[model samples]
Target chain A: MTVILNQSFTGVSIGAVLLLIALGLTLTFGQMGVINMAHGEFIMAGAYTTYVLQKPIGDAGVSLLLALPVAFLVAGSMGALLEWLLIRRLYTRPLDTLLVTWGVSLMLQQLARDIFGAPNVQTTAPGLLTGSVSVAGVNLATSRLFILGFALLCVAGLAAILRTTPLGRRIRAVVQNRDLAEVSGIATGRVDRTTFFIGSGLAGMAGVALTLIGPIGPTTGTNYIVDAFLVVVVGGIGRLRGAVITAFVLGLLQSVLEYSTTVSVAKVVVLVGIVAFLQWRPQGLYTVRTRSLV
Target chain B: MTTTSTPPTAAPATEPPAGPPETPFLGRFLGRFRTPAAFLLGAVLLVGVAPLVLSDFRLGLLAKYLCYGIVAVGVSLAWGRGGLLVLGQGVFFGLGGYAMAMHLKLADAAATGETLPDFMLLYGTEGGLPWWWQPFANPAFALAMTVVLPMAVAALLGALVFRRRVKGAYFAILSQALAAALAIWLVGQQATTGGTNGLTGFQGFFGYDLNDPINQRMVYVVIAVALLLLMAAARQLFVSRYGELLIAVRDSEERVRFLGYNPANVKLVAYVVAAGMAGLAGALFVPAVGIISPALIGIVPSIGFVIGAAVGGRASLVGAVLGAIAVAWAQSTLSDAWPAGWTYLQGLLFVVAVGFLPGGLASLRTVLRRRRTSSDRVGATKGVTT
Candidate 1:
C-alpha cells in the first residue's frame, strides 16, 4: 500500500510535467492544426533562459521565480516569429509544415548545441525546492509537489483565460470558423500568432518546471516532445479537459507498467496500448465537432 | 494533416481547383515515353556504365546509395502519389533487415558448429536459439520472411489505421511512435536482438565469400539489378489504373467513396507495396553495409528517406531514385569533411526545397490539382474518376 501510494505520487508528478509540455501543443497543434515539430526547441529555449539568468542573479530562488515569466516571453516571441515567418505561409498545407518545422527543429537543435555545447548542464535547485516532505507514510519530493501545484495552477489560469477573456473568445471563434470569424472582423492571423505565443509560452513554463527535477541538455526537450504530442493526440484535437485526463492516465499507467517491467518494455507497452486505444477511438477522447467536408 | 481543421465551412477558396495544363501533340508524345526512357537510362547507368567507370570501393558506395534509392521509390508511390506520409518506414526496413541478418547469423553459427550467435555466448545464454529465430535458420525461409514480415505488418497496420480514417499528422505521428517503439524494444532485448551493436561480423552472404573483392562486386551487381527491376515495377504501378484511383482518393476521399471505391483498401495496397519495397531495400542493405542496427533504422534514418524523395521529386520515379542517391552521396562525402555542417545543410535544404516545391512534389501537385478538377466534373456526371 505504501509503495502504491509513493509510485502513484511519482506517476502523478510525471503526468504533471507531461501535461505542462502538452499544454502548449494542445493550443498550437489542437486549435491551430499546425504540427510544429520545433515546439520542442521552444521548451529548450525556456530551459536555456533559466540557465542564462542564473549567471547575473546571485539568488537561485529569486532567479528561478524570475525565469518563469522571462522564459515565457523568450519562447513565446520565438514562436510568434516562427508563426509570422514560416508557419503562417504554410497554413493551407499542414504536411509541408511538418517537413519545414522538422528542418527548423534540426537547426534549433544545432543552434542549442553550438550555444550550450554538446554536454548536459545542471542547475542548482533552490533551497526551498531541494528537499522532500513525508505525507501519509510516503516521502514526496518537494520539487515534484511544486511541479504538480504549478501544473494545476497553469491549468486553472489557462482555463480561465480560454473561457472568460475576449482574446479567448477570438481564439475560439477563429478555431471554429476562420472564414466566419474573418467576416465578423476578427483578424485570424493575429489570433493565430497570439495563440501560438501563449501555447509556446506554456511550453516554456513546462521547460522551467522540468529543470526542477533533472539536469537539462540541448536534446532535453526532444525526449519529452513525442510523449507530449501523444498526449495531445490521445486527448483529442483542441480539447483541454481531454488532454489533462489523458496525460494523467498515461503517466500513471507508465509508472505502474514500469514498476512491473523494464523501462524499454514499459515504453513499448504504452505505445502499443496507445495505438490500440486509437484503433478504438480514432477521433480521440474528445473530438471536436466539425462540419467541413474533405 | 487535414486540408483544414476548421470546424465550420471548408472555404473552397483556400484549395483552388486545378485545371489541365495545355500540352501540344509533341509534348504528349514525349510525356508518354519519358517515364520508360528515364528508367532505361537509370538501368544503363547502374548495370553497364557504373561497373566500367567506378572502382570497387566507389561502386560499393553506389550500391548502398541505390538501396536508399529503392526505399525512396516506394516513398514516391506512398507519399507523393498516394499522399500518405509514411514516417515509420524505418521499422519495416529494420524488420526485413533483421530477418535477413538472422539467416546470415544462423548460417555463420552453423558453419562454426555452434547453435548460438557469438553475442549470445558473450552474454552467457544457456539455451539454444530462441523459438522465434528457429525458422530463420533455413536460408530460403529467411529470404522470403524479409519481404513477408514487413508487408504483413504494413497490411495489419494499414487495415487498422485506414479503417479508422486516421491520417495526416495523426498517421505520421503514429508511424513515428512505431519507429521509436521498435528502436526501444530492440535495445532492451539484447540477448535475442544483439542489442545496441546490432547483428554484425558476417563472413558470407548466401555462400558468397564477403571478404573477396570479386564477391563484393557481385553483391553490388545484384543490388543494382534488383533496384532496376523494382523501379520498373514501381513505374508500372504509377501508370496503372490502380494508381489513378489512389490519386482520386488523395485528391478527394468523399468523391472516390461516392464512386463506390474503398479508400482504405486502396491505401492499404499502396502501403503494403511500399513496405515490400522497403523490406527489399533493408534486406539488400544488410549484406551491402555488413550490418543492421537500430541506429540505422530509427526515427532519424526514417526521415532520411523522406528527404531523399522530397529533394528528387517525390512523384517522378527517376527523380525519387536520383534524389535518394544524391542525398546519400552528399551525406557520405559531406559528413566526412565536416560532420556538423551536413545536418545544418540537410535542414536548410529540406526547408528550402519542400517549402518552395509546392507540396514536396511539384509535378504531382499539378497532377493532383488537374485530377481534382476532372474528378469533380466526372463525379457530377458519370459518377467516376478518369
Candidate 2:
C-alpha cells in the first residue's frame, strides 16, 4: 500500500511537469491551431538559462528562485519572436507550420549541443528541497512535493489570469472568433503574441522544475515532448482544464505500468493506448462546439 | 450550398487549356510519354555514363544516393501527389531493410552450418534459430517478405487511421510516434534484433561476392533499374483517373465524398503503394549500403525521407528523385567538408523551403514566369495547394 502511494506521488510529480508543458501546447496548438514543434527546445532554453545562471548567482536557493523568471523571459521572448517571424505567416497552413517548427526544433537542438558541449549538465536543487517527508507510511521527496505545490500554484495563477485579466479575455475572444474579436476592437495579433509568451514561459518554468529532479541536457526536452503532445491531444483541443486532468491521468498510468513492465514496453503500451483512445474519441475528452458547417 | 455557383467559373477556368486542343495520334502518344522518356534518358546517363567516368567508390556512393531517390519517389507519390504528408516512410524502409538483413544473416549462418546467427548466440539462447526468422533463410522468401511486410502494415495502418478521419498534424504525429516506437522496440530487443549495432557484416548477396568490384557495380545497376521501373509505375499512377481522384480528395475532401467516392480508400491505396516502394528501396539499400539500424528508423531519418521530396517538389515525380539525389549528395559532401555543420545547414534548408518556397525547386520556372508577368501574382498565390 505504501509502495503504491509512493508511486502515485511520483506519478503526480511527473504529471505536474507534464501539465506545465502541455499548457503551452494546448494554447498554441490546441487553441491557436499552430503546431510548434520547437516548443520542446524552448524548454531546453529554460533549463540552459538556469544552468548559466547557477554560476553568477552562486547560492543554489537564490539562483533557483531567480532562474524561474529569467528562463521564462528568455524562452517567452524567443517564442514571441518565432510567432512574429514564422508562425504569423503560416496561420492558414497548419501542416506547414508543423514542418517549419520541426526545422526550428532541429536547429535549436543543434545550437544547444554546440553551446553545451554535447553533454548533460547537473543542476543542484536548493537545500530546502533536498530531504524527504513521511506521511501515512509513504516517504516522499521534498523536491517532488515542492514541484506538486508549485504546479498547483501555477495552475491557480493561470486560471485567475484567464478569468480576470483583459489580455486573457482578448485571447479567449480571439480563440472563439478571430474576425469577430477584431471587429470588436480587440487586438487579435497582440493576444496571439501574449498567449504564446505565457505558454512558452510556462514551459520554461517546467524546465526549471525538471532540473530539480534530474540532469539537464540539450535533448532533455525532446524526451518529454511526445508525452506532452499526447497529453494535450488526449485532454482535447482548446480545453485547459482537460489538459490538466489528462496529464495526471496519463502520468499515473505510465508510472503504474512501469512498475509492471519494462520502461520501454510501458511507453509502447501508453502510446498504443493513446492511439486507440484517439480512434475511439477523435475529438478527445472535450471539444468546443462550433456552429459553422464544413 | 455555398459551392452551388462555383462550377461555372471553375469549369471555364480549368477546361480552356485542354478543351479545344487537338493533335495527331502519334504526337499525342509521344506527348504522353515525354516525361517517362526523359526519365529513361536520365536513368541511362546515371547508370551507364557515370560508371565509365567515376571510380568504383564514387559509383557506390551514387548507388546509395539512388536508393534514397527510390524512397523519395515513394514520398513524392504519397506527400507530393496525395497530400498525405506521411512523416514515417522510415518505418516501411526499416521493415524492408531488416527483412532482407535477417535473411542475409541467416544465409551467412547457413553457409557455416550453424544453427543460430552470431548476435543471437551472445544474446539469445543457443537452442536454434528463432521461430520468426526461420522463414527468412530462403532468399526468395526474404525478398518477398520485404515487399509484403510494408504493404500489409501500411494498408492496415492507413485503413485504421483514415477510417478514423485522423489527418493533418494528427496523422503526422501518429506516424512519427509509430516510427519512434519501432526504433525503441528494435533497440530493446537486442537479443533478436542485433540491438543498436544493427544487422551488418555481410560477405555475400545471393551468392555474389561483395568483395569484387564487379558485384558492387551489379548492385548499382540493379538499383538504377529498380528506380527506373518504380518511377515509370509512379508516372502511370500520376496520370491515371486514380490520381485525379487523389487530387480531388486533397483539394476538397467533402466534395469528393459528396461525389460518392471514398476518399479514405483512395488515400489508403496511395499510402500502401508508397510503402511498398519504400520497402523495395530498403531491400536494395541493405546490400548497397551494407547496414540497417534503428538510427535510420527514428523520427529524424523519417523526416529525412520526405525532406528531399519537399525540397525537390513534392508534386513533381522527377523533382523528388533529383531532390533526393542532390540532398544526399550534399549531405555526404558537406559533412565531409564540415562534419558538425551539415545538420544545421540541412535544418535551415528545410525551414527556408517550407517557409518561403512551398513549391520547392520544381516551381522555380513558374515562379520566375510569374515574376515576369507581375499581374498574375494574385492568381498564382491563389493556386490550389495543400
Candidate 3:
C-alpha cells in the first residue's frame, strides 16, 4: 500500500515536470502553429542559467529562486529573437518552420556544448529542496514536492495572464483568427513574438527545476523535446485545460507502466499508445469547433 | 510508359506525374536527347569513370555515400513531391540494419560453431537465442526481412497516420517520436539487441571475406547498382499517373478526396516505398560499414536523411540522390578535420536549404532561369520561389 501511494505520488510529480516542460510548447505550437524544435534548447538555457548563477551567489536557494525569472527572460528573449529573425519569414510554411527550428536547435546545442563543454553540469539546490519531508507515511522528497508546487504555480500564473490581461486577450484573439485580429488593429507579429517569449520562458523555468533533480548537458533538451511535443500533441493544439489533463494522464500511464516493465519497454508502450490514441482522436483531447476550412 | 521515361532531370523533377500534363518548353526542347543523355551520364560516371579514377578505399567510401543516396531517393518522393515531411526514416533504417546484423551475427556464430553471437555471450546467452532471432539465421530470409520489415512498419504507421488526416508538422513529430522510442528500446535491451554498441564486427557478408579488397569492391558495386535501380524506380513513380495524384493530394487533399480518391492510400505507397529503400540502405550499410548501432538509427540520423533530401531538392530524383551523397561525403571529410564544426555546418546547411532554397540544388536552375526571364522586375522574388 505504501509502495502504491509512493508510486502514485511519483506519477503526479512526473506529471508536474512533464506539464512544466510542455506548457511552453503548448502555448507556442497552439498559438502560432509553429513547431519550435528549439524550445528544448530554451529549457537547456534555463538550466544553464541556474548553473551560471550558482557560481557568484553564495546562497544556493536564493540563486535557485532568482534563476527562475532570469532564465525566463533569457529564454524568452532568445525565442523572441528567433521569431523575429527566422520563424517570422516562414509563417506561411509550417513545414519549413519545423526544419528551420530543428536547424536552430542543432546550433544552440552546439553552442551550449562549446560554452559548458560536453560534460554534464549540475547545480546545488538549497537544503530546503534537497531534503525530504515526510507526509502521510510516504516520505516524499522535498525536491519533487517543490517541483510540483512550482509547476502548479506556473500554470496558475499562465492562466491568470491568458484569462485576465489585455496581452492575453490579444494573444487569444490572434490565435482564434489572425486576419480578424489584424483587422481589429492587433499587432499579430508582436503577439507572436510575445507568445514565443512566454512559451520559451516557461521551458527555461522547467529547466531550472530540472537542475534540482539531475545533471544537465547540451543534449538534455533533446531528450525531453519529443516527450514535451507528445504532451502538447495529446493535449490538443492550444487548450491549456487539455494540456493539463493529458500531461497527468500520460505521466501516470508512464509511471504505472515503468513499475511493471523496463524503462525502454515502458517508453515504447507509451509511444504506441499515443499513436493509437491519436488515430482515434486525431485532434487530441480537446479541440475548438470552427467552420474554417484550410 | 515510354512517355514517362522522358528524362526527369531535364524537366526540373516536378509535376505532371507520368507525363507532363503540359510539357514545359524546357522539357519539350530537351525531351528526346535528354533522357538517353542522362542515362548515359549515370552509367558512365558510376560504372565506367568512378571505378577507374578512384582507389579501393575511396570507392568504398563512395559506396557508403550511395547507400545514403538510396535512402534519399525515397525521401524525395515522399517529402519533396508528395509534401509529406517524413522525419523518422531512421526507424526503418534501423529495422533493416538490425535485421541484417542479426543474420550476419548468426552466420558468424554458426561458422565458429557457437550457439550464439559474441555479444549474446557477453550480455547473456542465458535464454538461448530469443525466438525472434532464430529465423534470421537463413540468409535469404534475412535479406527479405530487411526490406519487408521496414516497409511493413511504414505501411502500418502510414495507414494509421494518413487515414485520420494527421499530417504536416504533426506527422513529423509523431515520426520523430518513433525514432526516439526505438532508440531507447534498443539501448535498454542490452542483452537481446546488443544495447548501445549495437550489432557490429562481421567476418563475412554471405560467403565473401570482408577483409578481401576484391570483395570490398564487390560490395561497393552492389551498393552503386542498388542505388541506381532504386533511383530509376523512384523516377518511374514520379512520372506515373499515380505521381500526379500524389501531388494533387499534397497540394489540396480535400479536392483529391472529393475526386473519389483516398489521399491516405496515395501517401501510404510513397511512405512504404521510402521505408523499403531505407531498409535496403541499412542492410547494405551493415556490409559496407560492418556496424548497425542505435546511434546511426536515431533522431539525428533520421534528420540527416531529410537534410540530404532537402539539400538536393526533395522533388527532384537526381537531386536528392546526389544531395544525400554530397552530405554523406561532407560529413566523412569535414568531421575528420574539425569534430565540432560538422554539426554547426550541417545545421547551417539545413537552415539555408529549407528556408532559402526549399526546392534544393535541383531548383537552382529554375530560380536562375526565372530571374533572367523576369529581369525587368529588379530583385523580385529575391531570386527564389517556394
Candidate 4:
C-alpha cells in the first residue's frame, strides 16, 4: 500500500509538469488553431534562460523566481516574432503550419545544440525544496509538492486571466469566430500575437519547472513534446481543464504500471490504451466549440 | 464557388495563330514526350536501370529509397487527397519492420542451433523466444501480420476519429504523438523489441543468401515493380468514383455528407489503404536494409516521410514516389558528403518548397507547359504575319 502511494505521488508530480507543458500547446492548438510544433523548443528556451540566471541570483529559490518571468518574456517575444514572421501566413493552413513549425523546431534544436554543446545542464533544487518529507510512511520529495502547488497556482491564475481580463475576452472572441471578431474590429491579428506570446511563455515556465526534477538539455524539449501533445489530444482540444485532468490520469497510469511491470511495457500499455480511447472518443474527454466543420 | 462562376470574359486570351502544316506523326510523338508522361517514363526507367548501372553499395541505397517511396505513396493518399495529414505512418512501418525482423532473427537462431538469439542471452533471458514473438516464426504468418496489424490499427483509429469528425491539425498531432510514444516504448524494451540499436546483422531471408549479388539486384527489381504496381493502384483509385468522393469530402465534407455519402467511410478507406502500403514497405525494408530500429520509425522519420510527399506534390501519384526517392537519395548523398550540413540543407529545401513552390516538383511541368504553349502561339502568329 505504501509503495503504491509513493508511486502515485511520483506520478502526480510528473503529471503536474506534463500539465504545465501541455497547457500552452492546448491553447495554441485548440483555441488559436495553430499547431506550433516548436512549442517544445520554447520550453527549451525557458530552461536555458533559467540555467543562465542560476548563478546571478546566488540562491536556487531566488534564481527560480527570477527565471520564471525572464524565461516567459524570452519565449513570449520569440513566439510573437515567429507569429509575425511565419505563423501569420499560415492562418487557415494547419498542415502548412505543421511543416513550417517543424522546420523552425529543427532550426532551434540545431541552434541549441551548437550553443549548449549537447550536454545536460545541472539544475540545483532550492534549500526549501531539496529535502524530503514523510507522508503516510512514504518519503515524498518536497520539490515535487512545491511543483504541484506551483502548477495549481498557474492553472488558477491563467483561468482567472481568461475569465476576467479584457485581453482574454478579445482572445476568446478571436478564437470563436475570427471573421466575425475582425468585422467587429477586435484586431484578430493582435490577439493572435498576444495569445502566442502567452502560450509560448507558459511553455518556457514549464521548462524552468521541469529543471527541478530533471536535467536540462538541448533535446529535453523533444522528450516532453510528444507526451504534452498526447495530454492535449486526450484531454480534448481547446479544453484547459481537460488537459490537466488527462495529464494526471496518464501520468498516474504510467507510474503505477511501471512499478508493477517495466517502464517500457507500461508505456506501450498506456499508449495502446490511449489509442483505443481516442478511437472511441476522437474529440477526447471534453469537446470545445470551433469554426472547423470537423 | 464564386471563382468557378467567372468566365473568360476579358479576351480570347492570346490566341494560337496559323503555322506551317503540321506533321501529325511528329506532333503525336512530341506529345508523348510531354512533361507528365516523360516524368513517369524517366522515373520508371531510372528505377529499372539503377541496379544494373550502380554498384552493390548504390543498389542498397536505391533499396532504402524504394522503402521511403512506398511510405510516400501512402502519405499522398491520406494527406493529399483525404486531407488527413497522418504523421504516424512510422508506427505502421515500424510494426511491419519489427515483425519481419523478429521472424528473421528467430529463423537465424533456429538454423544456428541456438534456442534464442544472442541478444536474449545478453539480456539474461532463458534460451527461448517470447510467446508473442512465436507467431512470427512462421514466415507466412509474419508477412500476413506485417500488413494486417497496421491496417487494422489505422482502421480502428480512423473509424473513431472520422466518425467523431476530428480532422486537420488535431488529428495530425494525435497521430504524431502515437508514433513518438511507440518509438519510446520500443527503445525501452531491449529484451523484446531490439532497443535503440534495432534489429541488425541478418544473414539470410528464408533460405536464400542475402549477400549474393543476384539476390540484391533481384530485391531492387522487386522494389521497382512493387512501386509501379502501387502507382497503378493509386492511379486507378484516383480516377474511380471513390477517388472523386474522397476529393469531394476533402474539399467540402458537409456537401458530401449531404449527398448521402459517409465522409468517414470515404476517408477511412484511403487511411487503411495507406497504412497497408506503409506496412508492406516496412516488411520489404527489413530484408532489403537488414535492420529495423526505433530510430527509423521515430517522430523525425515520420515527419521526413510527410516532407518528401509534400515536396513531391502529395496529390500526384508519380510525384509522391519520385519525391520520396529523390529526397532520400539526396539525404544519403549529402549526409555521406557532409553529415553535419545535410540537416541544414534539408531545412532549406523544406522552407523553399513550402514558401515558394507549394505544388512541388510536379507543378514545374505545368508551368513549363504553359510557357511553351504561349511561345508556340507567338511563333505561329509571327509566321502568319511574315
Q: Lowest-lDDT window of 10 residues in candidate 4 chain A?
A: A285-294
Give me the displacement of residue B63 in model 3, in angstroms: 1.3
Give a tens-digit lDDT track for model 3, residues B188-264: 99999999999999998899889898898888888888887887777788888998998887777777888999989
Candidate 1 lands at a TM-score of 0.93
State in Å the error of residue B53, model 3: 2.5
- Superior candidate under DockQ, 1 versus 2: 1
Best by TM-score: 3
Model 4: colliding residue pairs: none
- lDDT rank, highest first? 3, 1, 2, 4
TM-score of each: 0.93, 0.93, 0.95, 0.89
A163-189 per-residue lDDT for model 3 (tens digits): 999999998887777788889999989
What C-alpha lDDT, on a 0 to 100 scale, does residue A57 get in candidate 4?
A: 77
Give the Å error, residue B193, model 1. Answer: 0.9
Which ranges in model 3 have alpha carbons more than 4 Å from their true place? B1-31, B372-375, B378-385
C-alpha DockQ of every model: 0.50, 0.42, 0.50, 0.29
Q: Which candidate do you rate higher for DockQ, 1 or 4?
A: 1
| Per-residue lDDT of model 4, residues A1-294, tens digit only | 998899999899989989999888877776566778889999999999888899777788899999999999999998999889888865546677778887888878878877877789888878988899998899989989988988888888888888799987887676666678889999878888888999999999988888888888878888888888889778986667899899999889989998998887787788778767877787778865554545
Residue A264 accuracy (lDDT) in model 4: 73
Model 2: which residue pairs collide?
B80-B314
Tell me the tens digit of each residue's lDDT in model 1 across B1-386: 23333211211111224333787888888877976787788778788998989998898898899999989889988887777889888988999999999999989888898888788889887677789999999999999999999999999888998998888788888888888889888998998998899999988898888888888888888999998898888878877899888777766777788899999999999999999999999999988889999988888898888998887777667777888899999999999998778889999878876766643443445546656766677455542211
